[model samples]
Target: MAENPAYPVGLRLTGRKVVVLGGGQVAQRRLPALIAAGADILLVSPEATPSVEAMADAGEITWHRRPYAEGDLADAWYALIATGDTEANTRASAEAERHRVWCVRSDDADAATAWTPATGHSEGVTVAVLTTEARGRDPRHTAAIRDAVVEGLRDGTLVAPHHRTRTPGVALVGGGPGDPDLITVRGRRLLAEADVVIADRLGPRDLLAELPPHVEVIDAAKIPYGRFMAQEAINNALIEHAKQGKSVVRLKGGDPYVFGRGMEELNALAEAGIPCTVVPGISSSISVPGAAGIPVTHRGVAHEFTVVSGHVAPDDERSLVDWASLAKLTGTLVILMGVDKIGKIAETLVAHGKPADTPVALVQEGTTAAQRRVDATLATVGETVRTQEVKPPAVIVIGEVVGVGPRTSA
Candidate 1:
């Protein structure tokens, strides 16, 4: 800490003039925050990076297309002097000082009247960290600290319960495939804030352990043809928790809407007069195969990829998927929740004119430490799965694209 520390403040630069004397990387980085603050930015530089030029082209900032002039900072509320030239930057800094404009110098922080803090935003909160020059002015260290704070706040590890406004409602959050890190930032944040979390067996199960002890975590283990919580019971739990003025999060694996029956839960919440926020996750149909180094659609191989739920057999009367039509298409087929019925699924496709020798790959527990890929042909997939003991929550890719990329197996 310095004897005389710089006072930290938030600038409301909306509709205010902010002059920038550079178009290099530094200016390119700083301009976005200025634009986001609704600042009327004026950039003066003979040449700029392509990204900076694109911003000027998009009318986000005004480009002077010349060197900085003396009057550039005349009416500017703030200025950024980042022109690499020593003399030019010094001149712009002087001009800004004469006009009583606070200026940040990228090349020389000690000489600058103002310093930009390492900043991060989470939800509606803005986190800014500034270190005194006396502390050696380590931007990297400050940035690291900023990241730690932001992540803690986002994951709910650091919480100021009394300071936050708790909105009691239900959020249908897609936890994404099986990896804990695959969960969306919004979904993770809601989970961190949840008073009650009703989780599915499939999604990032590890995240449940991270929840605070006060959080009631219900295992809505809707396992296929097994002991599980009923849909109605899950809905009632969500409604009941929310009615008690507690925040509820219904966390499901992969995308909630993509065969996760998310709509049913959402509809139930709506009927109960409970507000619901739907946060979509990365669906396993595409991501799982990709994680196993298989592209669902590769150029000159597969132009289209179709995602179909294999929970029910293709020959089942209740099945909505047209396996006959799918077999006719010269594209990729991504099947989710079809491990047990894969033999029947493959037989139906083969019977529908799909070649028995077509390539097939099963990616199990994709994007997680337990992830593994098994390769086979449409004809051999059923036997291979049975012999290998392939389990539920695996994504089966059937197409030429499966053979396109380098095979990765556990």
Candidate 2:
């Protein structure tokens, strides 16, 4: 800490004038937070980086498109003098001082009246860390401290017993393809705070191991065409736990709504008068194929990509997908939960006039260490899956895009 330690505070600049005297890297970095704070920004610079220009173009800020001129800080509540030009920055700093506006100088931290801290957010809490120039003003060190605090808060390792407000409800959290790290921060935070976690066989399974020993972890065990917990039973579990004043998290793979039967749970919870929060995850339909180096849609090669659930065979009366129409389309096709019925699906597509030579790739247990990709043509995919012993939770990608990038065949 310096002899004159800085007093930290958060400014609510909503609808207040904030003058930014440069559009360089520093200004580019600082403008977003100011904008998010709902500051009425005025940017003065002869030229700006493309990103800053985009903000101005989007009408988020007013860009003068000229060098910093005197009187620019006349009515500003705060000023950021970041124009790399030394003389211009000095002039602007002097003007800000005369106007008594809080100013941050990118060139000279000691000369500025205010300093920006390395800031991060977790749940509804904001973590900001500041260091003095005498302490070397290492932004990276400050950021590292900020990140550690935020991560601890999000993972429940850090807690304020007095500030804790537990809301008892069901949160439909999509754990993302298979990687624990891929889950959204909000989803992870909710899991950290959960008292009861009813999880599926899919999604980020590793996250379950991280939950506190006191948490009740129920295995929904929803395996396709296998021993599984009934949907109704799962709903009852969520309702029962939440009714007991416990925060329940229904952890599912991919997006809860993307064929995960999330709406059914929401409807059930609604009838039971329970609150539910849906946290969208990275769907295996797109991400799994991507993890295997397969793009769902490639420019000129594929104009569109369709995601379809193939749990039911194409010949099954219960099947709602139009196999014939799907076969006629020239875009890419991504099939989830179709490993067991891939043979019939391939046959139906070929019978409906899809090319037999269309490239196909199956990504199994994608985004995890056990992930593997097997490549084949549309005609050979059925047989390939059998010989390769591909399992459930595989994403089947079909079209020229499967062959677009460097192949990642197992």
Instruction: Tell me the tens digit of each residue's lDDT in model 1 across 45-159.
Output: 9999999999999999999999877788889999999997999999888887788999999988777889999999888899999996634788899999999999988866676
Tell me the whole-model lDDT of each prediction, alpha carbons only. 0.89, 0.89
- What TM-score should be assigned to candidate 1? 0.88
Cα lDDT for residue 306, model 1? 95
Predict model 1's lDDT versus the native: 0.89
Give every collision pair in model 2: none
How do the predictions measure up, each by TM-score? 0.88, 0.79
